[model samples]
Target: MGQGRGAVMAELMFWEAVRRAHDEELSNDPMVLVMGEDVGVVGGTYKATLGLYDKYGEDRVIDTPISENGFTGLGIGASFIGARPIIEIMSVNFAWLAMDQIFNTAAKVRYMSGGQLEAPVVIRSPGGTAHQLGSQHSARMEKVFMGIAGLRVVTPSNPRQAYGLLKSAVRCNDPVFINEHELMYNMKGEVPEEDYFHPLEGSEIVRPGRDVTLFGYNISVHWCLQAAELLSRHHGIEAEVIDLYALSPLDRSGIRDSVTRTHRAVIVEEAEPMVGVGAEVMAIINEECFYELDAAPVRVSALNVPIPYNHSLEKTALPDANDVVEAVRSMFGV
Candidate 1:
């Protein structure tokens, strides 16, 4: 939504958009609190919460100890008592320590309690193989979170989505997990000046075409867009680009609609292919649009090996725009 009449749009880096969202939501809702390591005093590991500590003070923008399980559980518990807490795990790899709180408590509270309880908790974390962060640190664990029942999973690809999605998640009654990319914090894009909420469901058609569908989210979205451009210019093959921002409760109808129109599909991701987003999307294609397809759905994903710290190996382990282009060429037999 372009700013209503007099409202002007401003360009902001992804992290800035996130900080703005946090700042606005905290101001609008007194119950809303942000808790995490360095989130208060240090303004977040990626500076996504920069300057909020002083503005909101220590109580609202409280900083916790390094214990992921302790702080995450504490936030989840507070949510049940009417606190709309935004809990940021410093890194997704560290989230393993908080699985009990996330999967068992926050996710299951509403269902297990028969709607009497609500887990209005938002867990946000940044993950990905960003510039040789190593195997442990370079974890793309969105698939793991998406698979959990009673949990809402979403990943934002740009500054606009980053701002809107976070705002929406804070207000949602169901527990929301926002998987952000490690490398996209400094990425710049236009964001609306006024407050807005991006739906926690549905896929977005970023680019329209008829030949094939390219599905991506987060960092891989840029790859799909780049590949779509090359396919159109060099090969005369128009590829549609779809952003699957919502991972859990995926837009099944959207996938069917796109594949039915294009008759071919290519799912791109920055994670390994096994049991990942690409695999799940391919399954959806087979189940819902198998008869409409002209070719087998393909996936462009990271290699099955652990992400190496060495720069060359790290680059080789991940799929890129060229990989997406090559996959599209193979589909078209170009």
Candidate 2:
């Protein structure tokens, strides 16, 4: 119905969409290239770049040394002079090493240079807890990236979003950070048979309802959807689920419209509660829809602690569908 795909086809996995998008873009442009550790021969730690090395050759599909700041800065420099480079920082935790390049150089270059130059680069990395990675490895750093002044941060919830958003990011004139989830690579969803590029701004309503509105991005979007179903079947509460694919330049109006109709809001996030996405959404609601709300907005977020290596403790640290259901129930005193 909407733009992007010309036809509908079989379900595609998250990584499959990523792979296809890389193949398509690399084949379409000579200036486009991929640079990351293990991306060339090993085909990426998550196999998202499988077969790209053989197809694009050594130059186009480069395997960089184990240096996040060095390779990321190199990619940014390349983008300034008309080259489009997709830099992969194996994990978000490692991305901290490149924070200077990402925040200072890539984000501020255009405005600081008085619009004389732009960094047309895309940084793709997986974040959030997966299995028992724990503590240092389990940071969901989207909030930090979204707070930057001139950067665009996107977190794709499904395969279609993953495919279309990645394509769109490459064409963007400014730097784009794509926060993929480690747990979502094998996730499957329906994608079009043809190429399509999703817009870098705005949000999508995945489910329609008349009661409370649930907002989430990336892995949290699925949790919101599940909560919506539980609310419908168990508590007779119909939650309208919205997927916030675009993290930065958030769709404030879209959230306002949804909350205006539903009259209640529950923001979900996989990250810590303090100064996170949920906090931002709550602030937006308080600012824009304070009069429209029937009660205070609720945030179902991860506990404020290092994600544990123990399986049970790890599960306990994060919010789940049950937590969402309870939060909604508490909103209406049910």
Q: Number of the top candidate by lDDT?
A: 1
- In order, candidate lDDTs are 0.93, 0.93
Over 4 Å off in model 1, which ranges? 1-7
C-alpha positional error of residue 237 in candidate 1 after TM-score superposition, expressed in Å? 0.4
User: What does the lDDT come to for candidate 2?
Assistant: 0.93
Cα error of candidate 1 at position 333, Å: 1.3
Q: Among all windows of ten consecutive residues in candidate 2, which has the lowest summed lDDT? A: 1-10
Measured by TM-score, the strongest candidate is 2
TM-score for each candidate, following the candidate numbering: 0.97, 0.98
lDDT score for candidate 1 against the true structure: 0.93
Alpha-carbon error at 59 in model 1, in Å? 1.0
* Per-residue C-alpha lDDT of model 2 across residues 1-334, encoded as one tens digit per residue: 2454447666889999998989899998999999999999999998889999999899999999999999999999999898999998899999999999999899999999999989999999999889899798999999999999999999999999998899999988989999999999999998887878888999999999999999999998898999999899988999999999999999999999999999999999999998899899888888888999998999999999999999999999999888999999999899
Superposition TM-score, candidate 2 onto the true structure: 0.98
